[model samples]
Target: MAKKKQTLFECQHCGEQSVKWLGKCPSCGGWDSFIELNQAEQESLKYLSKQTSSDKQKAMPITKIEEDDVVRFSSNNTEFDLVMGGGIVPGSLTLIGGSPGVGKSTLLLKIAGNLAKSGKKVLYVSGEESAGQIKLRATRLDANEENLYLLPEISLEAIQNEMLRENYEAVIIDSIQTMYSDKLTSAPGSVTQVREITFELMRKAKESRIAMFIIGHITKDGSIAGPRVLEHMVDTVLYFEGEQSKEIRMLRGFKNRFGSTSEIGIFEMTANGLESAKNISNRFFSSSKEQSGSCLTVTAEGSRALILEVQALVSHSTNPNPKRSATGFDTNRLNMLLALLEKKLDLPLNSYDVFINISGGIKIKESSCDLAVIASIISSFRNRPISRESVLIGEVSLTGEIKDVFSMETRLREAISCGIKKAIISTKPKGIVGIKCFEVDEVSKMLELF
Candidate 1:
């Protein structure tokens, strides 16, 4: 046999590499990321075989490629399907990231059961959990997946070989960080190993037209497992965002190539498994029972809109600066809103300890929550109650102006569906069907409406 040959390239970011023409990269997603290094080498047969491994690697005109019409798979939980933009696309790759004990594996196992029940072949490759452990959890979930297959393996080559031997319809790789390839000298979870393993799976997925769901661990900074490029290589990215202590879990799709990325799914975690909440709007507003400093807000996640409750408590501060804390939302954003409240309306937030919460243990990032945040603070300071039937959606500017938000139409419709009669939005009333509407450009004007 001839000697093996190798070619190298410089990483655009760190100037270290041994590959060429990688968009973004295994290390980073920086654009035009690879620079080839010319080297004298004999034409090799093995390297050529590796390059010709998949039909998806063939060159084709962009116009000739058909965008796969998006399809939905029954996630067993309607809410999960909604978050997945109707359903999981065939041959698509999904990366689900979350903290430990946040139920990442459990959620995927539940989905595997659903897929297997729907007459699809599902292979669950567990690099973290044991075969018996998954079965025990499956028993608790009451899942009936006679077609589901389980493989407790961490080696990438073994999984790839097994995949080629069968005609599985779907695959789930539990925790990508744990899986490794023997071809790479780097240890598993290292930058090189993660990249190699992911590429192997990607090649397999694209060639087989089988969708793959890979669960990932979150770093201390709450980023998905492995280098950020793992997300760029995948077709869709999802995050299971919610507090573990709370029964409510929010599944958010941050990116989707086959469907809308703006969708969100709401589920309540029960001892059995995640169950879909049909009347999510009603569930959000049900907690508002004449509670002081509690207000309703309409926010949009992906394509789906929702009404969420914002709760605030203002107490006399023993600390000179007062404690400004918030949960299920950004604390820095909360502080800026407080500053705007004080500057625009002369609210005495400096003397009070302000705490804000997005009820139901779900995080809200939409700027539309600005109005509700302001209203909650005011209500808490005044010890007053906000109208239970009213909801607010707007963004607060640094100069105390309430700005127009994206997807106002969707937000308004969600409010209406939730039985909200009055809405305070920042735009001029444009005659949306149903419900009373008030518009204000600045927070000062909004204060007058309340």
Candidate 2:
């Protein structure tokens, strides 16, 4: 006698399984999410089918295999290479997430052009744009690749069939949310569908030893859309972050299994294409002078170091309560810092309206930007202009003490490369030669230097 199969309703919004149907899923707390799926069909295959003559697998010994011996495909761009460590590793799946019109497709297209130039076959699968539309954009980007193939389709099974037939060096999927499989009844972009499709792609990438690039959609909160586990399934997760209004788009590496996770690739959006910004420090600060209420700071993102500008303005408020506003920085953190200043230093903030802005439209969350935030607020209060070449890099404690941050050497090196002579750091930074370094333990001590 055959074994009996189980039955349950699955949540479409959160992929939860339920024994009984309810208006809302108990596991995910979502309404009307339960969808019935065949129990036997829903269960993933426990073991791989026996390989016939047609299905061959790579055979290797655990000890005999050398990771360093694996061949790497260079994207042929220095900045991109840095972000991807040495180069693209084989059998790696990378997910690129960003907002709409953040140059996700443009950057990937440029990479495809570069890979094709080096005599590598590239396959670009676009579900969001037509082949003709991609072609026009590629032409504008000056992409003349004879080996690049473009296919406009959203069927996952069809894409898998094509992958089995072609021998491409690199494969790029425009957006993962649009792709779906017929095996699942869920609609495209649904939680069940997105999770299932990404898992299938991961399996394909591993089995074929092919490097795949997946572009993902971001939620309204600026995080990647789909289940939270989607980020963990990929070998590399990159977030293309920057203000929509600014031309600068920062490619930050949130996770990298093949390389360091602290790397960032800087690119500037141009009419022709996305150009790599080499002098990141100069590019961020060269346009600004000794302006009042503006503060310069060196911050770190993963393995990459950066110099950022922090600006604050204080004005008299007509309302009984003063207004506080901040951009690219945390508003609550600003308020806490203000409270610290008011209670500890007895500064005047209740009567004055305070506003803070991080120049270049880049959002900073690292505590290293704390010193710069304080300096900017003080500059506004005193109506003083911080030196144009001066830069601050440190973290601030709740008790008004300066704290040391990580990668001090790297941050200082980046600042020095751009001709920044002075840096206010939490501790004495080492490994950087021939530069002025001021070590301060408290934020108030910084007021005298300014």
Candidate 3:
């Protein structure tokens, strides 16, 4: 008698497995995402699991384990290197994801050229674009280096064979979703194919000490399009943020095994290609004449301090439900601030439709801009223009108390560099020069400054 074959179903979105098919995936809440695996795919999954389990070694004492020395090399891009934790680590797998036309492919191609110019043998593999298409881009980016080779192939076996044929130091995969393993029968970009390809690439990178960069497409929700396991297997995860119409782009790191993830890399889209933006201190805020409904604030991004402008618009609403909208800032926090203003300042904000915006394409994640938000809203309501030389750097609480934010001194220094003369905060720091500071402990006291 022949042996019975086992059946399994998996979620395409999150790789959740079940013994039987279901209408919706219980793990990821995806409707109708369960697909039954073929015999070949099922067997491949089993073999992969067994191979991983069999490789586990016996537990050893912590003192007996030896530490591995970490080595890094520059990718020749300052902003790229900064986001990659100083430099690129050999045998590291990095995944880059972003919206369409956000400069993911352009940035990597430029870096590949830089690496090739530095005398490192590099391979640029594109499963989506042809060799001629990439060559045209390379010409525009000035990335047509002698050592930079392009291969328009999708077969994993063929790619592996080519890698064996050459001594390439770094590899770039245009996308992980486009690559498929012959061992798996599922379609390319499927959950199984992505997982299998990533695992193989990771193993190859570690065994050969090759640095690999894989581009991934993001979903509608801005997450990488594939199983969650794809992110887990990589050493670092980076996301490109900026509208295509805008010239400024920011690369932020979400995960890193070698360095802190707080650092962000800023780049500018020019006629040539994406270049690092060195003088970005004044990029987020304008130095123009003072206007009502606009206020300046300083917030910290990692080790760097950024001065951003908070803009608000207040108008009487004819509808019973006043509209509330915020762009590049949290809407819920804006509502909370509006409520706080109504209760604390006796301001009739409930009858007005409030809108808030952060200047530039940058998003404000920290609460240090709360005071500035309040100031902008009030300035708009009163139709009074705030002084452009003054900066606000504090957080407001529900009890109407002004709270000091972290890195207050750093924020003040950035503001001073941008020609700011005054700063309103919860407390004054000792021995600070250049910018004058005013202390206000309560929100009611803060309104007096206006």
Report the Cα RMSD per candidate: 6.0, 4.0, 1.5
User: Which stretches of model 3 miss by more than 4 angstroms?
Assistant: 1-4, 54-56
Model 2 stretches astray by more than 4 angstroms: 1-7, 11-13, 20-69, 286-288, 318-321, 430-434
Better of 1 and 3 by TM-score: 3
Q: lDDT tens digits, residues 148-185, model 1?
A: 99999999889988888889989999978889876655
lDDT of 3 by residue, 1-450 (tens): 998888899999989999999998988789999999998888778876785786668988999999988889999998899999999999999999999999998999999999999999999999989999999999999999999999999988989999999999999999899999998888999999998888888989999999999999999889999989788889999999997878999999999988989889999999889999976978877788899999999989888888889999999998899999999999999999999998888999989999999988788888999999999999999999999999988999889898988888888888888899999999998878999888888888767877
Error of 2 at 308 (Å): 1.5
RMSD of 1: 6.0
- Candidates by TM-score, descending order: 3, 2, 1
Error of 3 at 259 (Å): 0.5
The predicted structure with the larger lDDT, 1 or 3, is 3
TM-score of 2: 0.87
> What's model 1's lDDT at 146?
87
CA lDDT of every candidate: 0.78, 0.82, 0.91
For model 3, the run of ten residues with the poorest summed lDDT: 47-56
Q: Sort the candidates on lDDT, descending order.
A: 3, 2, 1
Model 2 superposed RMSD (Cα): 4.0
What would the per-residue lDDT of candidate 2 be over residues 273-343, giving only the tens digit for each residue? 88988667666665446878888888887667878888899887788889999998999888988887787
Q: By TM-score, how accurate is candidate 1? A: 0.82
